[model samples]
Target: MQKRQSKHKGKSALAEKLCPVCQRAFSWRKKWQRDWQNVIYCSKRCAKNKITKEPKPCE
Candidate 1:
């Protein structure tokens, strides 16, 4: 018997985006399929610790 082809492609073929909070490259995920455009953080931790204000310069 032949193996069935999956609807989804390989990981390398998936799209990628940089996480604003961690500045790391993240690939598309099944959970974010519908809302991939709105994803900004790599993980929940980064989302919670997102930068809210610019860092103050040392005097």
Candidate 2:
């Protein structure tokens, strides 16, 4: 049997995005295939700890 080729096999860098909450880069995941565009946080913990209020600008 032959192995199937993955569309994202060599596009790792292109499949990554920064998490707004942690300000860290995260790669694409199979579980997020259906909703990759809607992904925001890197993990559940970050999602839970997401900022609720906007920070006030310093004068």
Candidate 3:
């Protein structure tokens, strides 16, 4: 049987667990399993806004 690690031992950092855009806790699911780290926004709209605000790749 697959064992779940202790919450305190694995991915326990609160800063790494929240969405940067909405500041909401991330809901774990199969879809989010892979992009958990890159998940800055809770939704696509926020992600778009972040990209749009950027003047360019390099200034």
Mind giving the per-residue lDDT tens digits that candidate 1 earns over 1-59? 99999987789998899988889999999899999999989899999999878888899
TM-score of each: 0.70, 0.66, 0.41
Q: Among all windows of ten consecutive residues in candidate 3, which has the lowest summed lDDT?
A: 9-18
Residues 1-59, model 2: lDDT tens digits: 99997765465555898988999999888799999999999999999999878888899
lDDT (C-alpha, whole model) for all candidates: 0.91, 0.87, 0.63
What TM value does model 1 have? 0.70
The Cα RMSD in angstroms, rounded to one decimal, for candidate 1 relative to the true structure is 3.6
The numbered model that scores best in lDDT is 1
True lDDT of residue 45, candidate 1: 95
Shift of residue 20 alpha carbon in model 3, Å:
1.3
- Stretch of 10 with least lDDT, candidate 1: 6-15
lDDT of 1 at 43: 95
Q: Sorted by TM-score, highest first, which candidate order results?
A: 1, 2, 3
lDDT of 1: 0.91
